[model samples]
Target: MKRKGKRKMLIAIIILLVVVVVGLGGALFFTAGERREARNLPIGHVNFKQLHDGTYLGKYEGGMYKWRANKVQVTVSSSKVTDIKLIEHTEKQPTGITDELFSRVIQSQSLQVDTISGATLTSKAYLKAIEEALEVAQE
Candidate 1:
């Protein structure tokens, strides 16, 4: 009787662990899929003239669960970034923090912005996605 009780408890523990693992995995899958989708989106091939003489819109996304989206519609002239506009800022994870960090990225086209200290991964992911978006819009 004692042996049976221990086996049942062990099985229950294993099942619970599996459920948690599966749930976390699903969240990651969705997050990654969203990011990949952004990369594939067609921006209509921004002409060099448009990039330098007109404006274009672009977007970025990064999050594990309850993602924070970033978008910047920028204007470039003479190979220099002139103005940037935020389309939708869904920074659901860290409130207003990511926006501030994004501001830093704009000031200097480097993710070495502020680091965000603890949310390092989130910051890097956001920056990378933005870089990808910029690459698309410029190309």
Candidate 2:
């Protein structure tokens, strides 16, 4: 009787552990999917030409679970994007990813550039920051 009781308890504990592990895994998967969806959302365009020729500070916090740029400085000169500086960011990717995105923005003088393939969330956040900064320039 004692042996049977111990076995039953052990089985119950194992089942509970499995349920907890599966639940946590499901939660993580759902959160990751939500973040991916947020990353894929449209990055609004900003017409650099409409912005004044000056430096502007922009900041954007991505949706829950997404990467974010806490602060960005966008410099506009002669109705063009002259520089993009990431002042603060929460991206874990290397700096090269940021540089590539900044280069695209400067080259196109617009926010409608393609996102970095592997760092889509960071790219979107950077673009959103630039757009917000340009919006400030317009005011």
Candidate 3:
């Protein structure tokens, strides 16, 4: 009788441990999925033809993460993006990714451009800020 009771207790402990581990794993997986979705979100564009010629300020802070562009300033002139400025960003190192992204927006006149490879989160944040700024300029 004593041996049987010990065996049952041991089995119960093992089951509880397994349950805890699985729950933690599931939580981590879901969190990672959310981050991935945010990073891959499709960037939207503004109808430059309908946007009034002016400067606009936009800002975006990415999900719980530190890698993001805090603010951006965009200038539109005659239905074209004339300038893009990164007002603030949160990169630990100087990567020039923001500069490259700004140049692309100015040249293409659109936010539907490829993101920088290693700085995907920062690129997305910058694009989002540009979109927001342009949205304000819309007619």
Candidate 4:
């Protein structure tokens, strides 16, 4: 009877350990996935023609989305970007080039400017937000 009780207790302990290990492994995988998604998001698919001419507002949400979040208010008339106002940008890791290129785009009405070295994605995201705002203005 004593031997049987000990075997049952050992089996129960093994099961609990396995469950704990599996849960931890699953959590780690999800965390890693979320991190990768924020760091490697594609920001180059923005279409320019979608932007309409006129003043518009934009907003960028924080968190993992911050990697992709950028907002700007742009005024476009006759296909020219007369003004660009950055509303809220939470670019935590993007390069300083975003700001430099942003000024160029506002003055040029074209995102054809060069990408900020090391901050290419952030630059794209800022343009995307500006583009998105202009697009909204068209409607």
Candidate 5:
């Protein structure tokens, strides 16, 4: 009788562990899917000529779970993207990414620039925010 009881308890513990592991795995899979989706988000072509001269604020709500959400203040002057300021971001220090990416955008005067290596998703999110700010400037 004692052996049977112990066996039953052991089986229950094993089942519980399996269920926990499976649940955690499923959650991670879904979250990863969303993260990947954010990376693939399309960046639209922005015509600098159409943008008005002003500072506009914009934001990308990141992915489904907002892990990469960010905001930017884009300055347009003389029909050019003069500057891009990182107002808010998820990174502890996004200076490097923003410096490189924003300079590329300013130099090109477009949002179709290549994303920074190793920070593709972050680049896209920031670009999206800049796009939004430009869209507002156009209006």
Candidate 6:
């Protein structure tokens, strides 16, 4: 009787472990897909010359899982991107992308600026939002 009880307990523990492992694997797979989609997001060209002086709001609806969703307020002055403010983000922690990175966009007068290291996906999402705001300024 004692041996049977031990065997049942061991089996239950094994099943719980398997369930946990499978759940983790599924979550990882989903996250990997989301990251891949974000990494491949296209950053289109924004013509500063066409943008009128104005403040515009833009948003990225996030990719597959909406994990990186963000919004920005972009200011265009004299047909140039004068400033970019991060209004909101879904990231769990700050990704070190801030004024300096936005400064690059303003300085370049383009959305093709280099992304922040180790924050490529977040950078792209923000850039895309910026591009959208610029597009609105164009109209």
State each model's CA lDDT, in order.
Answer: 0.58, 0.82, 0.80, 0.65, 0.89, 0.87
TM-score, every prediction: 0.44, 0.75, 0.69, 0.53, 0.77, 0.79
RMSD to the true structure for each prediction, in A, is 6.9, 4.4, 6.6, 8.4, 4.5, 3.3
Deviating ranges (above 4 Å) for candidate 2: 1-24, 33-37
Q: Poorest 10 consecutive residues of model 5 by lDDT?
A: 88-97
Point out the higher-scoring one by TM-score: 2 or 4. Answer: 2
Clashes counted in candidate 6 amount to 0
Ranking under TM-score, best-scoring first?
6, 5, 2, 3, 4, 1
- Local distance difference test, candidate 4: 0.65
Question: If both were scored by lDDT, which would come out higher, candidate 2 or candidate 6?
Answer: 6
Query: In TM-score terms, which candidate is top?
Result: 6
Q: After aligning candidate 2 to the native by TM-score, how far in Å is the CA of 4 from where it should be?
A: 20
lDDT of 3 by residue, 70-92 (tens): 78888889878898887887766
Cα deviation of 80 in candidate 6 (Å)? 1.0
Q: For model 3, name the residue pairs that clash.
A: none
- lDDT for predicted candidate 5 compared with the true structure: 0.89
Q: Note the residue pairs that clash in candidate 4.
A: 51-135, 52-134
- Candidate 2 lDDT over 1-139, as tens digits, reads 9999999999999999999999999988878875776667676766556888889999887667545646899888887789989898776778899899999988887888889998777778778888889998877
Q: What tens digits encode model 6's per-residue C-alpha lDDT throughout 52-136?
A: 9889999999898888898999988887888899999887646356676798898888888899888889888888889889889
Write candidate 1's Cα lDDT for 1-139 as tens digits: 9999999999999999999999999988867765665444432222333333456666555444335466656655676555555556665546455667667765664434555776655555565555555565565
Give the residue spans of candidate 1 off by over 4 A.
1-53, 61-66, 93-99
Spell out the clash pairs found in candidate 1.
none
Best candidate, lDDT:
5
For TM-score, candidate 1 versus 3, the one ahead is: 3
